[model samples]
Target: MVLFLKRMLLASLLFLLAGCGQTAAPALPTKEKAMKVQIEINASVPNKQPTKLTLQRQDLVHKLYTTISALPVVTDPNRPCTMELGPRYTLIFTEADEKTLIEAEAQRYGCRPVIIQGERQQRDTNPEFWKLLDQVLREAAPPATVQKLALLHNGQTALIDSAQQAQALYDALIKLPPVPEGDPHQPEKQSAYQITFFTAHGTLSGTIDKQYARLEGNEQARGGSYYVNDAFMQQVQDISKSAHYAPGRPDALTVTVSGPEISMRSFIDTQSEDAPIMQQLYTKITRLPQKAASCSTEEEKRQKKLTTTSLHFTQWGLPLLSVEIYEGEHCQQVLPGPGSEVQPDDEFWNLLHKLNR
Candidate 1:
């Protein structure tokens, strides 16, 4: 009976030892060297978005490598897997690994593992694409390349000859990253403005969206959209506001004023060499009051309709300035000109009279 008890105790002790020995396997070793790595998660499943994580730090890269390595690899070839809901992972390591450990480790984490071979394959395969893009960058580098820029917004055009603005725009374009192909099924938002880069070599046009820019076409005929950084877009807005009217040589200046029961038009010819007077006229025309007069009664409201005055300055048979003015009901009462009863002691009326004479 003593021997039987001892045997039973020994058997139980052995059983416990066996169970302790079958503990979980240890984690795999990680690569210690620094590496330029990019991990992309491409999900084909609905509502499962794709993500990309780039790592340059040695410690972080090692941690990521080890984490993937620890996962159990899918061994069964017949394992129930479908590409439709694929959570495929692509791991790109700049340094070549003879053992392909990273690829094997990535396989355990996703449906498939893709390894990038070298830098050459990462760029656009077409040689002409590179040449055209490089040419654009070169042509857009110098401020002198752009002679004139036409900015159109809300049916109003402002022609500018600012080198600072042109340089800012071109620099932003050159800094744009390579465009990635967007999902065809996804909808694209409308662009805010269109900028045409006129260089001596040729013309390049593009549209600027909130977060992206679309280059219309290239010499290779490869047109695409690229990501625009926030800093670049902000710079574009800052410089674009520099667009304003600058006085140019003109052949004639025509002024038209229309109000409730009043309409008057006048013209000025530049052949008279009225530079000083014209400058004063330009200043007065642009600085006209824009607010409408207040009226409370029905009769006053009927008489208080806003007045619109336009100054058309033409140069070499072309229109230079198409200035429009919309002022309150008191425009006729306050304006100093042929149609107004109140003639103030300002030179505005005198200049108008001289131009018309």
Candidate 2:
């Protein structure tokens, strides 16, 4: 059940947004027919025995499946992991008739893999996913549930107060699989994001990096960096952006170009003759496909050098959001913040150039 307090006009609008012109999310399989999932655990922490479990809730299974499905896909077999084989688990998806649909070997300790049985080395699973599964396994045993929930990032504070929204967001979060790391020891100075949740009891939060690798902590926690992959953060971000935009779209957007070969200039406001073109440009940016979770300006000296452009979304002439884009060949991505980045489609660049002309 969705659980959290509700207040403020924006929260109210957020609820109405379900049917208020907001795009409907893809529907999940019917619970009664496909919610039955079998989970197997081997040598979990503090235990040496293997155990069997089942998940019948449509909502739970749906969240788990969808979350992992959203992670960045990779073809490489090698991933960064701590090599702790102590914790091993498997999840079996089946129909009401017990017909198996898919099987997954879940590891939160080592490679943090949620690999489909027999598949090559590829994983979208992360420690957070394993942690969530751990909680689910524990919950299936009996009872479980979190604290003041909020998304802390990029100089903004948005409280996840609604029960439905909070539950959905957290559910989406844990479903994200962990990424493989090269060193499992290479440490990033900062995580760039902290997603907190409201349990029925207190609270638990995760500090996340661009690769989606994370660490569990309380308020003001930092995360570990493993790889450079994100797109998942967009889910977390758009959730906040959706709620924030509920009151109104930004009054204006600014596109400023600054790179090794160009002088910095700004295109402010879009209410003139080229308004339609400007709107398309704005939409292209807002809907730009994300790549890395974030990029840290603090680590600029250590990051790969690149040429890029920047954009700023503002309301009443005040900055609301900002992003930097690298259109170069090295790592063409939209940088959302310190340590987080995203990939934009050709449309983004084409529109950018068109508008610039």
Candidate 3:
């Protein structure tokens, strides 16, 4: 009986070990499922102070809904746009589409403009819309802040200490000089600060350097600001040369897709031996996937689609992954092979650290 009992215990232990061995880490999305994007704008505003703008869902669809609700009069769609300031000075767009009209109107009115998909039935002022509009009006109206600066490397983000810092940085961004018109090395103005955030999908480059801060609108402009170092700028240039780099005109960001089946998970890895606070960023980045999806849908003809989120840190000299998803037939564009899954590699992280420092 003693021998039998011992054998039973041994069997139980073996079964438990097998179960443990089979356990796997929680699943993360693949790169093929994600889409990478960036937004950039150049502006010249009257106020030097940073302006805060939010997208208004109501105002953007004014042409369609206003006619239905009998609020504002609808005009010919093919006429030229005539913009005027004041309560009565009407803003018009002759050739503007919904997106262009929204952006242009927002810039002219000094309010955050949101693009609404539907119509409004009533005329009552939306408390949130007025609040946002009022806040924008009362604050600075600096022009040309980056709507988005997507990294050639996709799906990356940079973590600030707090929302306040994020606001501060954003507010201060407009006063900074424009990103040099030419190569980063030969720009007419140099950046006061430039840092790149890396993620599994790609990277994000941020600049708040002195030349940018000295704009006419900025009352709080500083004389001696530290911008990105030469090595760092060169690194940015080098990354742009990769096969993935996509060029842009004055107002759009250049996106580069470095590798297939890219991972956006690095944006969330706060396990830095250097910055403990970065770990908390992992939790904050949960919205990354949703944010990426905000502006994109499955491209009708594209073979594959991916949603990616990424963040990089020059401060800690590390990059973290956040989220990645794979979709469609051509997702293999970033994938290794037919059935291979996405996995994190140390090689990219090492390169990020080297370039950032």
Task: Give the number of the best model, judged by lDDT.
Answer: 2
Please estimate how well model 2 matches the true structure, expressed as its whole-model Cα lDDT.
0.56
Tens digits of per-residue lDDT, candidate 3, 1-357, equal 999999999999878755432221222233222221111222354543332323223343332223212222122223333454322111222222232321122222322222212322112223444433332222223232223232312323233333333333444443333332232544334343344333332333444332232222221111222244454444444433432333211111111232235432223222434243343333333322221122222562253344332233223232223223233343311222223234333443343333223
**Order of quality (TM-score):** 2, 1, 3
**214, model 2: CA deviation in Å?**
22
Two-way lDDT contest, 1 vs 2, winner: 2
Clashing residue pairs in candidate 1 (N, C-alpha, C atoms within 3 angstroms): 292-328, 293-328
lDDT of 3 at 223: 21
Q: lDDT scores for all predictions?
A: 0.50, 0.56, 0.31
For residues 180-234, write the lDDT of model 2, one tens digit per residue.
4334554456556555565653455555566554534221121222233456677
Worst 10-residue lDDT window for candidate 3 reads: 247-256
lDDT of 2 at 171: 51
Q: Point out the higher-scoring one by TM-score: 2 or 3.
A: 2
TM-score of each: 0.28, 0.31, 0.21
Poorly placed runs, candidate 2 (over 4 Å): 1-33, 44-47, 142-357
**Alpha-carbon error at 5 in model 1, in Å?**
68
Q: Candidate 3, after superposition: displacement of residue 351 in Å? A: 13
